[model samples]
Target chain A: MNPSGLDKEIILNAAEEAIRRFGPSKTNITDIAKILKVSHAAIYRHYENKAVLLEAVTERWLSRVSRPLEPIMKENNDPEAKLRCYLKTLCQNKRSSVIEDPEMFENFAILTQNSKEALSTHVEQLFAQLEEIIRKGMETGVFETDDPREMAVTVFTATSRFHYPAFAKEWENPNIESLVNSVIDLILNGVKKRN
Target chain B: MNPSGLDKEIILNAAEEAIRRFGPSKTNITDIAKILKVSHAAIYRHYENKAVLLEAVTERWLSRVSRPLEPIMKENNDPEAKLRCYLKTLCQNKRSSVIEDPEMFENFAILTQNSKEALSTHVEQLFAQLEEIIRKGMETGVFETDDPREMAVTVFTATSRFHYPAFAKEWENPNIESLVNSVIDLILNGVKKRN
Candidate 1:
């Protein structure tokens, strides 16, 4: 990459780090530029403002995190297996993303307000993608849900909250795998005891 | 009530509102004093500092919210009923407390230190109160569970998150009640399909 391109990359990485440390509200362009050993004007050349830079960082973060799900979502034929994989992927990876990068998550929240249309568009796309997998499962008779959209919402909500216990103020047991399994089973098989 | 006692009540309410609006970091004693139409020095007479004022506000918030459960919890003879009532109480009441009172809950995060010790102390007290109900249900073979503590945590975490959709983002569904009921059912009965 050219020197300018390298500088931009460095600036973006430092911005992400700053967001992680000070949260979205506290992080500023000067802070990021200072950490990057570059002028604030140089950052402006690459990005319009702090908002734009934050949005780009959030986009990068989501793309990186969501990338792993694409393969399993595309290739997997078994709905149950796919659902299991999705939960496991979240349990093993997504949880760490929040715990490891709180600033990134907070930055994402702040950027969402700045660019509501863009944020909503991306959110709608994710929800649609999730709903498609759920609809497929319902069509295959692997899932017995009456409302796939609602079920999708419920499962996604429960799984997302599982990752961030700080916000929710509740946590599963240390046996995370079994906790994941039990929650997945509850969703898959409607929690009514079997004969 | 004595005039001094009434002034204390007024001060605490104002403090709670200030904390909720500005968050713990931004809220100051001057703001609370102004809101209560009292001298800033008067606040210092009752509480040493903002931190002390915040702790008192949080303790008051907890006591207010937890008070409603006391009757349902104390009166309930059955473990399953007690657990169900507890879950219902949390789902119905905890939402407003969290939503309307951000500082109160945020202060909880500070008090709890996001550790099992704080969590266990609260959960253990709740569990002990529900122990007889759970034990009686287990003895009668109504509830089939080996570890009530783990089950209590699971129920608490799931039900608590079920109500707070904004935090999770995935729970923006319209039919949240049904969704909550489904989770409750799954927990009460195991999720395996019945014959």
Candidate 2:
């Protein structure tokens, strides 16, 4: 197969599709190559190995979740609203991601557990989005926290039940939305400047 | 061996010791009986099967963690102090439990995952403790939450990273205490009445 017009993006999209279709455990470089109509060597030239390609696929999926939040952080001036939107979007995205293709999600969850580098990078990306909003909040005097980085982590940890994959099993619980809202209230109340 | 005087407590103690020594997968009723120097029938009389015995063992271990928190709820007059102590003790106890016997801890974690009744009962016990403190705080005007049950769940979810066994890998991070304290600060600020 011709290697012309084949790029990282094309390979990654195909890889994601392959994983989504066949699931991660059964996904192989050949499947991606076949999907891309390119030789395995072409994909190898870009990703070096199946693992690297899968990491890119995971990264791509993760970035899709973070990409929209960037504007919320950059464009929105209200820290409280920004924080709320960020958290709600994050929770919604994660829950939908799980709900859409639970089998693939579980496969990737297990895959990410074995790939700590990819896992940490994904976490750091989410943290960076939060830190940016928090830093802005502190700068604008809307929030009272001294360290936005620490506060961001605190928020992430505080809201893990809603967003974390381990707790996805409970997302179907009818009360999850109210639970998420309640926690958000508690967190917002926590970070807001004291009257 | 004679079955007289070999009560549930003795059998549970022996079962725990066997699990701690041989790990849950390998520990069996006969081993527990041998340790108790009683007939296997005696152990069987107390627990119908291995699953039941393991559940009882888990219940015993869980109770040990919760027993100390009971007085903190019932006897402590200051709700804030009680909340702080309950959280700290819970975190410390969970961390120590993991450290003391990681293998057995992992065993129990898996066991609890399979035993929904045991898991929910354990959760209810912890939530009950938090609810008591929150209710007291609300009554005394120290806390400003409308629903104490919701507040307790929020607190539990917020502090999960410190206490959840799945996050044990990150507990050794030197900054865990500071991170925990920062969260506690955020939560306290969240719950306390506005000045």
Candidate 3:
């Protein structure tokens, strides 16, 4: 609850914990309220109902991913280095989340299937950051592509083996990091301006 | 039945046709026999049962794809050009197969899920072809990679949107061909030696 007594974040945190432990299908508002030591009505004031709360939970989780990248996206670092770090950080975060809270992650994958609009927005938000980075590279003469939006999608697809959590089982492979680095090298070469 | 009458190919072709029309779940040996104009016992003599016949059908179908690529694999061409052609052909063949006969492709996908051994062998054969192409590229100092097998998987993952028929709906987009070519271009750049 962050010592604030009760706020949306507190309600969300409690809901997140409950969902993590019990799975989304079984978790209810009363359970979240029990964790918050408050009435379910209090949580309702913030999120409306179970479905809305779950949507909020997804939005919250996805925002954590986007929030950290915003600064990186706006950073003054070399475009290539920034892109490399951006992708590596995204993968590491998703991988650790999958490893530490696999049940929660699995529920999120299933939940997103029912929340396509939120999922699409989340995707667009991530792509916007990627497009920003690619556009910066083009402006600075570091990348050569004319279509930054398409290039961002290309980069996303190319790195799916690393950043996409569905392939988390493959992340346990000892060679995964090196292979990811090799793939990143290849992708970087693909986007870099040829002299 | 071929001119020789009631051979394995004839029975298998009948089975394939039956699967396509009725779908895998409803396909049966009797229907295949009906197509071949032979007694079910004649089909049974070649295949122990319906399951065995289905396995043979999958193997035969996969072989057709591999057979055509053998010469391209052995051809003395620029490694990059060979790879581009190889991947493009694979995608085109898969896309055409899906568009021309979606029912058969869907049945194959479902059937392959149950026939894991045959599916594993089919995957290995495709990976082997990919690895051979990567090895040739490395030998000619065209592509940059220390582990060709891992790189082959990476290539497969990168180009999956086009070659894997599961994404056939996405292939219907008017920009799909150019998008595929763009992705291919990115992948090619990723692999080429950085000298």
Candidate 4:
């Protein structure tokens, strides 16, 4: 997207790949440029600095976390089942990111520790997706709620331990899957309408 | 306790005071010894080193987090009210620890992040207290559950966002009290007996 005639995707891919292979501390703009066969200045045209570029990478990663659940939101399945799948997939996405590349994940955590603007946007996007699912459930007359957005926030915050980075270390417990399931069941039961 | 003419509690109190004043990095056994009017050698005679003393300080602090809830467990209030009081006190304990002394808390978090032996014991203590409340509720026929311990874990994990240090930044939201109440209602509704 910059004047170098290279797609922003290519530059991001190279940056991520370089960071993964070399780790964030050793990876620099020049290394990213080398991987993409473009001038570091070309990368600069898009990102004002390395910090901005890293934030973009973090933003992209955070944006993709809930992608697998998006299909569930649109599916013609029972909203309750859809809710379970949505939460499970959301938790899985976070767990797999930690398992697959812990170094890069830690790098992301450190780089964005003090600045949460990008993270706030990512969380809002997640909230909107969750809100849509709750709204659909309400429309189906299966959920009992006057405020889908508030219900969404309640459910999201409730299940945070299973997905949040702070509790990532607890994810490896043998009871983790069962724990998430129990919480999901409680949420579903709580939200179900009474005749 | 080790010919220092000082009780272990006195030493701990002095150590906590020194850490609060100088911060953790600047705090050392000699500083604590100075505070307690004991020789650095006398302090070493009781604690093997600064690390042991620091861990002990952390352990003592963790032990006290649930103290205020002890009376609620023995109260004759409705089980549901008891549950709410238990959770609220637990949360307030954590929140106050942050608000009253943000520096000390960050120090505690950093010191214990890698070594969770002390924290694991602390979490188990919390789980035990929660299990007691749920068991009483089940006995009163107010709660519906085949396994109180599991239910305890489920509810605790669900509401973790409101209490866990990772989401500490979000606790200041004006809606936090209402949000926590909403989640508590969802949990109570989910686990209440249908009869």
Q: What lDDT score is found at residue A103 in candidate 1?
A: 47
lDDT of 2 by residue, A12-50 (tens): 888878887888878999999999788888888888998
lDDT of 4 by residue, A1-195 (tens): 334577777878888898888876677899888887778788888887887887888777777785777777778888888888988899888888888988777766655563488888877877888788888888899888878898888988889898778787878788888998899999988888766
Better of 1 and 4 by DockQ: 4
Interface RMSD of each candidate, angstroms, one decimal: 3.8, 1.1, 2.5, 1.1
lDDT of 3 by residue, A47-81 (tens): 88899988888888877766777777767899999
Listed models, DockQ each:
0.29, 0.70, 0.38, 0.73
Number of the top lDDT candidate? 2
Candidate 1 regions exceeding 4 Å error are: A1-11, A17-46, A98-126, A165-178, A191-195, B1-63, B70-85, B98-119, B127-148, B162-182, B185-193
- The 10-residue segment of model 1 chain A with minimum total lDDT is A164-173
DockQ of 4: 0.73
lDDT of 1: 0.63
True contacts kept of each: 0.32, 0.76, 0.44, 0.78
Which residue runs of candidate 4 sit more than 4 Å off their true CA positions? Answer: A1-5, A21-28, A111-115, B1-4, B21-27, B48-51
What's the lDDT for residue A68 in model 4? 76
Interface RMSD of 1: 3.8
- Indicate the TM-score of model 2: 0.90
- What are the Cα lDDT values of the candidates? 0.63, 0.83, 0.79, 0.81
Candidate 2 wrongly placed segments (more than 4 Å): A17-31, A34-38, B17-40, B74-77
Which candidate should be chosen as best, given DockQ against the real structure? Answer: 4
Error of 3 at A192 (Å): 2.0
TM-score for each model: 0.65, 0.90, 0.76, 0.90
**lDDT preference between candidates 1 and 4, better one:** 4
